[model samples]
Target: MTQHSDVVVIGGGQSGLAAGYHLRRLGIEHVILDAQAAPGGAWQHTWDSLQLFSPAAYSSLPGRFMPAQEGEVYPDAAHVVSYLADYEKRYELPVQRGAWVSAVHRDGPYLRVETSSGDWRARAVVSATGTWTRPFLPAVPGRRDFTGRQLHTVQYRSPAEFTGQRVIVVGGGNSGAQIAADLTGTAELTWVTQRLPRYLADDIDGRALFDAATARRRALDVGRTDTGGVASLGDIVAVPPVRAARDAGLLCAKPMFTRLTATGVEWADGARAEADVVIWCTGFRPALAPFAALRLRGARGHIATDGTRAVDEPRLHLLGYGDWTGPASATLIGIGRPARDAARQIRDLLG
Candidate 1:
């Protein structure tokens, strides 16, 4: 039997939960579909030492603020998991765990969501599935031929596992810097980047980044001069650990290698370094496979959207992916506005 809902939220992560909170407040009936068997979403799958770029007060869902982790200026992954779990229980949100959605297609006036457990027909569908599942690795030559173990951020747990082994960390972004910093003293570490790593000011964090993004968006909305945002500052934030690593001269990064070798990697200048492992902190793509039948993706490989609503199909709202969905929507603090707006639009549509 096909289940039914007024709205179907794919992904019960921070974005989806925020959407649910607003929808419930507006008296809109909806269900959140989570691929994970438990709460915390992607946070649960992150490295053991992963910490939010912001403090606890700065990272929170819609109705509830994340509690501060005692003795920690920046909370760890476990604290976040506990907070998300508690938030879910506090609101009693209608989330169906382990409901991995396989596909979503049009079925008359409703969007048919086919999942591992069952199917649901909803008047509107919200795609909040963030990008952790689709870790991207650049097409560097000889990658497959390399004998060293290669793993993306998703597979990494801790540096202890590779202690004393020659390891290379790739990419210039936060993940790359953080992970490379985490590997200090634990591995024979070599950090490589396509370009020199850019670090944000030590005082700036996700809070400042979110505020900048909001300012930029607001400025653009009023047709004023465009203001720069997080990108304007730099890529990586000088979080405590990252800053410490840099001060200690452990976070130095080399230019990207020309190709992977059977034994390790080689640079264009013929410099070679043997390695036992390579960690790709390259980032991710949107997990939009469920919407493949919609044919909404543009030539840029992203779905064109008019303020969260898909331009090709207004019935579908894409959230939490990135700025394309909403400014800073991928972050916990930034998701609320878009989630509230998406919920309101959904309510108006249902009416």
Candidate 2:
């Protein structure tokens, strides 16, 4: 039987749960479809050593704050997963796990949501599918010929398996830096970035970046086009682990390689760096596969939204797709505000 909901959220991660919290507060009837068999969303699949950039208080969803794990200041991935599960239970949010969404399309007065297990015809659809599933791998010269193990940050786990091997980490982002640190004692590691890596001061953490981004967005909201030298997410934060790595002279990043060789990599001047493993810490594109049939994407392959609502398709709201959808919706702290706005818009639409 085809299920029906007033609204459908197409992910059960932090974004979806935040949206669910707001929807529940409004007494809106909705359902969340998750591809994962259990709760936690993409965090469940992240590398085991991953830790939030800030304390537990900073990494929270709407309505409920993420509790710090016992004796731990900053929560890890497992702690986050546990919190998500508890959040669902606390609110009794209707979530259908293992229901991987295949596609979504127009269906007369409502939108039809197709999934692996069943279908849902919803009055509104909030796409909270984040970028974790679709890891972006940049094209390096002679990429196909490299015979060694090459993996993206998405597939990264503990660095213990890489012990005694030569590993090269790519990208200058926080993920790249953290992973580089984790592989420090285990692997003979080399960090590579397109440009010189920018490390923020030790006091500047994820919250600072969020604040800077928020300020920039606020400035953009008004007529002012100038963003008075705000920091970007691409810059690395000086977390304890990263700082330790730097102290040990391990955080140095080399320039991007000129090309890949069968055994390793070659620099522009013909210098070679032999590596047994290559971990690409490049970023990600939004997971918008289900919205393909909607034809709502802008020139950038993302759904153009006006404060979370799709510009072309009003019934479709995209959440947790970074600043393009809403200010800071992609981060745990940033997601709550936009989720409330998106929920309000969806509730008003349903009414």
Identify the leading candidate in terms of lDDT: 1
- Which of the numbered candidates is closest to the native, going by highest TM-score? 1
Which residue segments of model 1 deviate by more than 4 Å?
none
- TM-score, candidate number 1: 0.98
lDDT for each residue of candidate 2 in 163-265, tens digit (9 for 90 to 100) = 9999999998889999999999899999999899888877766677678778878888886774642345447877788889988898889999989999899
Tens-digit per-residue lDDT, 245-318, candidate 1: 99999988999999999999999999999999999999999999999998887865789988999998889998
Weakest 10 consecutive residues of candidate 1 by summed lDDT? 293-302
**What is the TM-score (0 to 1) of candidate 2?**
0.97
Which pairs of residues collide in candidate 2? none
